[model samples]
Target: MYPFLRMVKELIKFRNAPAMRVGDIHISEHRCWPWDIDLWAELNNGRTLTLYDLGRIPLAQRAGLVSVMRKNGWGMTMAGVSVRYRRRIRTFEKIEMHSRAVCWDDKFLYLEQSMWKKNGECANHALYRSAITDASGIVAPERVLSAMGHSAQSPEPADWIKRWIEADAARPWPPMQDKR
Candidate 1:
């Protein structure tokens, strides 16, 4: 089930946060709840991804991206992701989430986020490709930035992210048919 209550709590917690630039980092604290654990008694991989949202939404809010979306009737969606889980996160363990926008391409924005343990070890990290959409289709990142009252000029995406995008582009859309 979606943690709508938690969502509201986080939203309210960061509501008054100062606006941030695209590359500015947003730090958030969270705990691994019992319900968030899996059979092995660690934070579930799926749950980890969902928990990332708690960090990202606040990032968008602080960056004023949410305001742009609201004003322009635009929406944001996850187009792709590459995540690495480095360590186990035990139940009730506290984590610090760090999130920031890396850069933007013609049609997508790239973001990087990480969950860190109190000992300074990284538990997980992810690179995300997000698209802004409206009634027509994907909106250009420059346009989205403009709507957010930001400069149209965008920094180039990281080489690794650019490689991933290229790899994704080469993949077959419908996939191979099963030879049953």
Candidate 2:
């Protein structure tokens, strides 16, 4: 058995340890600082949490998740991300964010996450996909499986690889200009 398999077996035993959650949003208290205002202001005419600040929650959560996998002797690299904002948040408003792993295939792991206002309304949602890799950043498929406590010949297949490739091909070169 691969050394990493032991860690995977342990993780599986406590797989449902807990639902990961994070965050609390802070709205603007003053408008004197234009630079700060510009950074936080949203297209919907409400102040937003700066990307720098909003990013902290996910960064910490990702670090924690990565630590879990690493402790199991598994390493991974982030591959793609998609975020959607549902409602405009203004100053003095509070929002809560939550994150959790939904599933994983042979090559990629999928995370489902969300943000909500104090009122319990969803403010945003996001999905993060990551690829398993080796210390050298090489895609070692069989190694990844073994690290996850699966047999080297596990039947799991990677469907996202094709989709990621096709999406890369179809992506536009540059974003469209805003006429306003």
Candidate 3:
């Protein structure tokens, strides 16, 4: 089951947080519970993605993207993501998470998130490409930002992000059909 209750708690907790502009970081902390563990007694890999929502959703609300989406009848969805997990997160251990929108292009918005242990080790990091959608199709990110009151052009993407975008472009769509 999804952690719907935990997500609601986070929403309520940040209901009045100071509004953040594009690119500002939103920080929060969370603990791993027994249900979050895998056979190795560590936080499950898939759960890490779900836990990220606890931060990402609040980040969106704080940045007013949620409001913009609601007002315009837009929906947001992840188009792609890359995550690196270097350290193990054990059950009952607390981690600090940092999340922020990095930049965007006409087609997609980018965001980054990370989790850190108390001793200052970065346990994991993820880069996400997302899109705003309506009934017709994907809505341009620039249009979404305009609706959110941010008119500035996107900051230059980092070299790694640029490389990733390039690399991903070479991957075939509707992948792996030949094997069947």
Per-prediction CA RMSD (Å):
1.1, 11.7, 0.8
Backbone clashes in candidate 2 total 2
Worst 10 residues of 3 by lDDT: 171-180
Q: Model 3 segments beyond 4 Å from truth?
A: 178-180
Candidate 2 weakest lDDT stretch, 10 residues:
23-32
RMSD of 2: 11.7
lDDT of 3 by residue, 1-180 (tens): 799999999999999999999999999999999999999999999999999999999999999999999999999999999999999999999999999999899899999999999999999999999999999989999999999999999999999999998898899887876565
Per-residue lDDT tens digits for candidate 2, residues 1-180, read 122442344345434444332222222111122332334553232222223123323333333544545665655556666667787555545555555444455566555555566677877665666566666564554454454444435333236634654575598767688899
TM-score of 1: 0.96
Better of 1 and 2 by TM-score: 1
- The sequence of per-residue lDDT tens digits that candidate 1 reaches over residues 27-100 is 99999999999999999999988999999999999999998899889999999899999999999999999999
Alpha-carbon lDDT of model 2: 0.46
TM, every model: 0.96, 0.46, 0.98
Model 3's alpha-carbon lDDT is 0.95
Please identify which of the two predictions, 1 or 2, would achieve the higher lDDT against the true structure: 1
The model with the greatest lDDT is 3
